[model samples]
Target: MSSRVQVVEQPGLAPAGLDPDAAYAALAARDRRFDGRIWFGVTSTGVYCRPVCPAQTPKAQNVRFFAAPAAAVSAGFRACRRCRPDSAPGSRHWDHRGDLVGRALRLIADGAIDDGGVAGLARTLHVSERHLHRSLVAEVGAGPLQLAVSRRAQTAKLLVEQTDLSLAEIAFASGFSSVRQFNDVMRREFGIAPSGLRRTPSERIPSADPALVLRLRLRPPYDADALGAFLAARTVAGLEEHVPGRRWTHRRVVPLPTRAAVTEVTVHGDHVVVRSGADVRDTAALVRRVRRWLDLDADPATVDAALGLDPALAPLVGAHPGLRVPTTVDPWETVVRAVVGQQVSVAAAGTLLARLVAAHGTEVAGESGLRAFPRPAAIAALDPAAITGMPGSRARTLVALAAAVADGSVALGSPDLDEVEAALLAIPGAGPWTTGYVRLRALADPDAFPASDLGLRHAAGALGLPEAARALGAHVSAWSPWRSYAAQHLWTSLAPAPVKEPS
Candidate 1:
């Protein structure tokens, strides 16, 4: 379904197109989504990015408008280290294409192009390579490979700007196939040697070779305290820690494929710092996973507006206009968290999670002292006694959950969420509420609603299930692809945060 509103080039702000003068006027608003989508290149400095670039906002005459980073690079502007305009999520224009094109963009970001060639990606998308080629060229001025190449170049830029990784490592990390290819593309894209892209040398960085660490950005009024409080409540024992002040703030390593090492994540303002313990050959791929896990790519203005139909949620909609549901950095951790939360209060589930991590998780040694979340095999290998305090029934369910995950009976990453929900039900003791929660939080499916959740149920009673489903579904269906965010608003709106009672 295409957006009723076409994304006309911001001829300024209105379709008539505003000059640099008017565009800068919008910048003073600190609109983060507009940061990269529009830019002004200073002729003097030869730099251009989103208006929100925190360095120094340039004067009107020095700026220029560009909808695409490739366009900016075409005109000669290196990406800023502080404001990585290249890393912005695909324009929401892609999202509104309720067709093969939209799904293709979503899947491409999920690493389809890097994993396989155009034919393979096209096949997964149920379209011909030729048709896929035409659609991308028609819409974005880049074919699938061109789009993927652009993404790769941006990834290279990030690694060059942030880390000490070699060009060869940076190439593969950025999803390029070879060192020469990486260097060639970087020069083509940025018109400079890859080596010249470095910003500054970090005095102290992680020992992980062939790894690149970068921060993922989001819009402001993010309700970080709410996000932290939410994580602090559900963070499992050894797998994650939100109560901080020790080593890496909120650190826990999740498993990676090549080496059985941990991946740590810490949240800064509007971004999460991912710390890799082992060298990652594909830095772009790693960053994509981190972005998906943190759910950072969501465009909030679109989401907030989509979720604002219901009057009951208007206050939450007002307080934090661009709220996002928390996301899981590791699918494995998501499964474990779901199993722990089954019949327990959020606090109880969190206690069990911490205990589980401490017992089976590996230690990440640093003053940022973190530990890797335990692996599926580790849980499968453990004694029932390790969950000593948990109910025997719950313990059995968890073991069954582990075995399912370990055996590939349930593949976790981006599972057809509905299928996963059905599979969860097939497991003994799992219910609709638990499965729904998993979809809403773990899978990041916007449409997944815990219709049976006490809060949702109460919120819906005024309408009844059929009426509620109709009313709620009708209300949030416009949120379409982002219904999970709408559900988060509905839930958070009723927040019963440990009360001193609102004065």
Candidate 2:
């Protein structure tokens, strides 16, 4: 451990039992494990850096810890250029909490405020704007608006460093209201003018390049092969393509509401590369969705610690240390797939889904060889018999789901998991298994588990564990907040090895 990074252990970091000593120790050791969980701001230098920063650490008395990047900025610190603290994986603490604060953070990351402002976000979460602001301040040391501002600053910084977009364009694209606001925020948060921060032309890639590529950082022990295999098995023919160990491609409406693009996601060693043909304006939103799809924000160390205590799961955890639950880029798309998957094998269900997309999906205009999944309105307008191969009951359920979403009766990406599940169950054919699967994949719920699924039961039996859904459900309750991940491990035990295929 570096002496400059070392600090005496102390217990007074937060009321939530976050130990300052532990945070400092991780910083001293230059441990990447704590990169997102704790950020150290140096009082003397007025800059904050990630725990894994290679630069010499500041003295203990000069160090202050913050739970989030926004909190550190609130205390008058700029981001360290050397370490790029803003790019760390999101804190696992927020991902595991099912409370209002947690959900609010997730929504904020998804650009809810950028799309609708604080009032709209409040409406979606079924809470008052004032209460939401108060809760965020008390829990995370910053209010909703400030959190949104911090997010924009991070996005702007990335653009400045990685792309050759003009300041005006980058400002508007990153959700800033004006070029002046963008410049002011950059100077305030990073202690550098926006133009001064930009790399020389040759050092950065032009935004007009055919593919907009960006690197997504994630925690170690990630089983990329497992995730690739899981998605490849469920991919729809035209809407998605997967070449195991190389890339996964999909076509979707980016930035929510409007822009359309084709995205190719590839997993490298510790980072995933997202290359898209979307407009430069939607890069920030595209990055956010891709991160969710890969579950890159999940904290693997925390997950391993909790699941490793169980004897049955210990070996599996050891085998696949950083296994993550694969999620969808679009909530409606996930719901449609779940409905199609009812009472079918993975391959058969994929075929039916591909047929549905081919019939109703809006084809992309370029050489992307992709089609956007039908919007809720498009699906809601259809007769049940219009979907060729789907069973009458399943088709009706899909239309009902589309109607609910279109009518604002079921908010897909809202922070309220209970409300989403209840709305899903009210549909005619959606049962516990379907609701659980949707929750896990669409809403990104960490604890969602379809314990009654036949595949899960088979995996449990093969592992010499409880074979009954009810019994297995009881046994896995101990894996609360991580049952979704446990289900992945169990399911992977039965899945065949991934093989490369043409894209």
Report the number of the highest-TM-score candidate. Answer: 2
For candidate 2, the per-residue lDDT at 105 reads: 93
What is the C-alpha local distance difference test score of candidate 2?
0.80
Which residue pairs overlap in candidate 2's backbone? none
In the range 1-503, model 1's lDDT, one tens digit per residue, is 11121222323241114455556776656565454346555555665556677777666655656645654554555555456566655444343344676667766766677778789888866779999988765544346776677787877777777777677777877777788898887876655788877766663345464334666665554555555556556666555555443222454555554443355566666666766655555465567666666566666775676566656555667876667677776766777777777666778777777777677778764444556777888887776656776777777777877888888776665325555677778878677777877877676665676665666655545433333544655655555666676567656656655322121
- How many pairs in model 2 have backbone atoms within 3 A of each other, for residues 3 or more apart or on separate chains, i.e. clashes? 0
Error of 1 at 365 (Å): 7.1
TM-score attained by model 1 = 0.72
Q: lDDT for every model? A: 0.63, 0.80
User: How do the residues 437-472 of candidate 2 rate in per-residue lDDT, one tens digit apiece?
Assistant: 998888888887799989989988877889898998
Give the residue spans of candidate 2 off by over 4 A. Answer: 1-16, 200-209, 245-255, 500-503
User: Estimated TM-score per prediction?
Assistant: 0.72, 0.91
